[model samples]
Target: MRFIIIGAGRVGLRTARVLRQEGHEVTLVERDAEKADRARGLTFEVVDGDGSRESVLQDAGVADADAVGALTGDLNANFAACLIAKHHGCRTVMRIDEDYREEIYQQYADEVDEIVYPERLGAIGAKNALLGGSIQAIADVAQSLQIVLITITDGSPMKGYTLSEVALPSDSRILAFGKANDPLGIPLPDDSLEAGDRVAVLAEFSELTEVRQLLVGDESAAAAVAGGE
Candidate 1:
């Protein structure tokens, strides 16, 4: 696959390197001469110009790209670049920095292929830091869903339960499970949940509280359930 990434910043550069390492063709577009020169040093094809401009993107072969990631820190530039990429028949992903504006931009998410929130993910990291132990968010699957890895502690309601016997909220389901220290893999129906084992679950945004309560009995989960009233 050929990917054109706008912005030669940390996110764009690292994304290009990883894609290149996977044997995909990657081209990076940057407006700054210094950044373009820096990208060239990394052995990636670099285009020095404003990514938001159609001509600049065209010069980077956006029309032939399998995918385009508009990852500049500037939101407007990223959005404009994505529009151009979408017009050129490339699947597009735009990086958004503000969480509050997510819903407004998400109205156009279907027009593009995806939207990313690196800043919001950083916030989630901060949340995990404060929450400490047991529960950890793995990724935001969508605006209303999250994939999380939870450890089964001794007092967890899920501890000692079999995979087939655990009751998840209607909006949630277990995606995978594995014993602690084991290579993470999909859980089998016969597998029993043991203390120290880890489970990965996909839950709707509204059901996260219940899901957490069932797993770790966290106070926030209980509070959420109460507040839902």
Candidate 2:
């Protein structure tokens, strides 16, 4: 796949590197000479220009791109770049800093394929940091659903419980489970939750608190996890 990234800052450069590592062709566009210079050393093609402009996008071969990632910090610029890319028949992904404005932008979301919130992702990171090692939110799915990976810590209420014995909230379900060294797969009735085992669960936003209680034990466990640095 050919990807055109409309920023040369941390996010764009990192995206380019990961895509290039996966053998995808990537082109990075930026307005700053220094940032463009920095991106030139990476695996992607680097173009110095204002990505919000049609001419600059044309120079970056956006018309021929299979996908475009508008990652500039400026929301308007990112939105404009995505619009141009979408018009050129490229799949567009735009990053928005403020998640609260999502509904307002949903009107234009059809023009773009995906909306990303790095700040929300950062909050997940902060949660992991504070939690120490028990539960981690892996991804935020569409609507209020989320995918989370949680470890069966010592003395957890879930420890020794069978797949069918564990009670999850109505809006939540365990998707997969595995022992410490085993490959993750759908949990079976015979499978038992043991210390150090990992489980993946899908839960709605409102049910997360109850789901956490069931998986992590109690409010004290949550407090201990949340109080960590």
Candidate 3:
């Protein structure tokens, strides 16, 4: 696959590197002389011009690209680049900054194939690391819903129960289960929960405490893990 990425800063360059490592063709458009030189220093093909300009994107081979990632920090530039890519029938992925108002975010979200908020994703990862323990937040599905990974411990109330017998809180559901040292998979009705087992659950934010208590137990252990860091 071929990709045209707008901007050559941290996010754009890192994304280009990953795509290139996977054997995909990548070209970056960077307006800044220093950034363009930096990307070129790493043996990347960079077009030196404003990414919002259609001519600049053409130089980066947007017409032949399978996808375009508008990853510049400038919201207007990113949106313009995505609009041009969409006109060329390319899949568009636009990056949005954390400072934008919710209404503006939603308006632009409807125009692109995908929206990425790097800061939000980074925060989620940082939070997981900080809250280390038997329970970890996997993702924020929405404002009110979250996906969490829970490890069954010795004191867990559900440790001796089967998947079919465990009753979770309202609006919560078990998504996947895994035995100790094994990869997670679809939950099985006959599978029994035991110490060291891991379970992935999707629950509303209000029900997370109950889910954690039922699956992990012993809150002090989790607190100790976080405090030790």
Looking at model 3, which ten-residue stretch has the lowest summed lDDT? 220-229
Order of all candidates by lDDT, from best down to worst?
3, 1, 2
Q: What is the C-alpha RMSD of each candidate to the true structure, in Å?
A: 3.5, 2.8, 3.5
* Candidate 2 local lDDT, 88-152, one digit each (tens): 99999998888886666776467778888777777778877776677787877755888888888
Residue lDDT tens for model 3, 112-207: 887788876776677777766678878777667888888888889898899999889989999999998999999999999999999999988777
Q: Candidates ranked by TM-score, best first? A: 2, 3, 1
What candidate 2 gets wrong by more than 4 Å, as runs, is: 219-229
lDDT of each: 0.84, 0.82, 0.85
- Return the lDDT, model 2, position 111: 77
- Distance from true position, residue 88, model 1, in Å? 1.9
Residue 36 C-alpha lDDT in model 2: 91
Error of 2 at 15 (Å): 1.3
